[model samples]
Target: MGHLKDMVGANVAELVVVRHGETTWNATDRLQGQAESDLTEEGVKQAQAVASRLAKTAKHISAVYSSDLRRASETARIIADAIGCPNVTEMESLRERHLGNLQGLARAEAHLVEPEAFKASISSDPDESIPGGGESLNQLHLRSKHALENIARNHLGQRVVVISHGAVLRALYVHAKGCQPAGRVRNTSINVFRISASNDWSLSLWGDVNHLQGTNLLRASQRGDEMR
Candidate 1:
C-alpha cells in the first residue's frame, strides 16, 4: 500500500519501527511473554546493523520509544546512539502480549502439553480471555492504539523510532491496515508507517528483514503452527 507522505512541519514525520533483536529465550525456543530478557550475541549484532543503516538513511529522528522489555530497550539504545539521540523512553503499553503461564514453553511443547487450552487461547475471540491467563487480542488492540495516539499527540512533527516486540509491532500493522492479525513479524526487521496531521495512519512496509541478509531468521514458533 502507498503510505501517506505529507509533511506537518518543515519535514514529514515518519514512524520508523524495528522489531527488537533476538534473545536468549528466543534462541532456546522459549516464549518470552512479557517477561524481561536479554539480547543474544547475534541479536546485539543485528541491532548494530539496523543502527548502522539508520545512521546512513534516516535523518531528524527527534525521539525514540521502546517496549519496557530489556531486549527491545537495548536494541533501541543502539539505534539512539547511531542517530545521536540520548536514549529511548520505555513504554509499557507497547510491550508484547502477556503470555501468562506459557512464559517459557516452546509452542510445540505448549500445544502437546496443553492442547485444548492452547487451542482455546489461540482461537479466542477478541473479547475472550486467553485460557492460561494473558492479555487478550482485544486488550492488545486497546493498548496499542492508545500508545500510538499518545505518541502522535506529543511528537506531532518529528520522525520517531520505535523499538518493540515482533507481535506488538505486527498488531500495530494489522490495526493500521484494518487486517486480521496474522501477519509475520521477523525479528530485528523494520516496518515503516506514517501519521498525518489529521491523525490518520498508513503502513508502508511490514515484517521486513532485509537487514538480516544472510542469517537464519527462523523463530521456534514458526516451526510450529504459527506460520501463516
Candidate 2:
C-alpha cells in the first residue's frame, strides 16, 4: 500500500505464495477450513523461520497479502514485519475452502457427524459442494484463479507475498500448474510463481523449505489431507 501506484512496473509479476504455519487444529488432526485457530509455539517459530528466509533470500517485495483468517494473517504479519513491508491486504478470496458443517471437526468426527458430506468430501464430483456451506474443489479452483489473476494484474512487474491456507494453495497449484502437488504442502513452505505480461502462469519453485533444513519437521505424509 506504500506508493505502489506511483512506482513504475515491469512486464512480469512474481508471487511467492505461502501456506500459513501449523495451528493447534492442525496438530490435533482437525480440519480448519474457514474456521479459526491460533498458531502453536512451533507455528510461531515456523513463521519466524520463513520470514528470515524471505528476508535473506528473496527479491524486494512490493506488497503483502493474507487470508482474512487469524492463522494466515498472523503469519503474514510476521513475514511483513521481518521484511519491512508495512501493509498487508487481507482478502476473503484468499481464505481456505469452506468446509461447511465439517469445519472444526476432526476427520473421524466429521465422518461420524455428517456421513454423506464426509463421503462427498473424499470422493465426490468436483462440482459438488460439501454439506452445509462448504465449497467444492471446482469452486475453490475458480476462486483461486480469479484471485491470483486480480493480484497479478494489479501489481504487474512487482513481487508480492501472499499468506494463505493449504486448500487454497492446493487449488492454486492444481489450477495453475495442471498437476497435484507431489506431497503435503508443509507449514510455511514457499511456492513461487510468475505471471507474464500476457497473463500466462509459470511455476518457479514449489515446497521450498530450505529454512527448516536442520529441523526434522518436513516429513509430512504424502498420503493424508492436503486440504488441512
Candidate 3:
C-alpha cells in the first residue's frame, strides 16, 4: 500500500519487472493462462523497442529472468540479447495465474458460460480463485513474493530484469500498492521496484511504456480475461 522506499534501509536490490509483449490470444481477446502463445509481429517489434530502451536506461542489469511461457521467454531473450546478459533463467513461478477452465476462452464466452465464476476471477479478493483448479489471487501474490525475494537475496544490491505476465504482475502490484491496478498493463511495460535487505518491497514505477510512444503498439482492450 505504501512505497517501499519509505520503509527500507539503504541496502536494497532494484528489480525491473516487464510484462510480455502481445500475442495472438491478446489480439483475439482470449484468455491465455498457462497455455502458450507466440508473439505477434507487432509484439516482436515491441520487444525490440523495449529492449533498446532498457539497454540505454538499465545497462547495469545484472541478470534476466522470465516466465517459461513462450511469450515471456521470447521477450526476455530479446532484452537479454540487447543488454548482453547472455542468459535468461526461466521460472515457472513467474507465469500468469492458471485460468483453469477459462483458459483459451473468449471473454464473452467465459462470462456467458459462468458469469459468477468469471466475475470472481476478476475480483480483487486475494483468496479468490477461478473455478476448476485455478490458482487464487493470494497464491499468485505469494509466488510472486517468493520469486522476488529469492532474486533479491541472491542478487543483492544488483539490478535485475524479470519478464512476466500481466495477471502475475497485477497480483504483485496489488501486493505492493495494496489495491487493484487502475488499468491494464500494456505489452512490454516496465515496472520498477526495490527490495530492501530486510526483504521489504517498494514500487518505484508502474505500467511504464514510454518507449512505445508513437509506436502504435499499445492495445485498447479492457478485457481482464485477456491478461492471462
In model 3, what lDDT does residue 97 have? 86
Q: How high is the CA lDDT of each candidate model?
A: 0.72, 0.81, 0.81
Poorest lDDT segment (10 consecutive residues) of candidate 1 = 219-228
The total number of steric clashes, by the backbone 3 Å criterion, in model 2 comes to 0
Comparing 2 and 3 on TM-score, the stronger one: 2
Relative to the true structure, candidate 3 has a C-alpha RMSD (angstroms) of 4.0
Assess candidate 2 and give its lDDT. 0.81
lDDT of 2 by residue, 19-132 (tens): 888788887888878889898777888889889888877767999999999999999999999999999999999998888878888866888898877776776489988888
Using lDDT, rank the candidates from best to worst: 3, 2, 1
In model 3, which runs have C-alpha deviations exceeding 4 angstroms?
A: 1-10, 123-125, 220-228
Q: What is the lDDT of residue 145 in candidate 3?
A: 85
For each candidate, C-alpha RMSD in Å?
3.5, 4.3, 4.0
TM-score per candidate, chains pooled = 0.86, 0.91, 0.90
**Candidates, ranked, TM-score:** 2, 3, 1
lDDT by residue for model 1 (42-77), tens:
778888878887777666777999988898899999
Query: Could you tell which candidate, 1 or 2, scores higher by lDDT?
Result: 2
Q: Give the distance in Å from residue 93's predicted Cα in candidate 2 to where it truly belongs.
A: 0.3
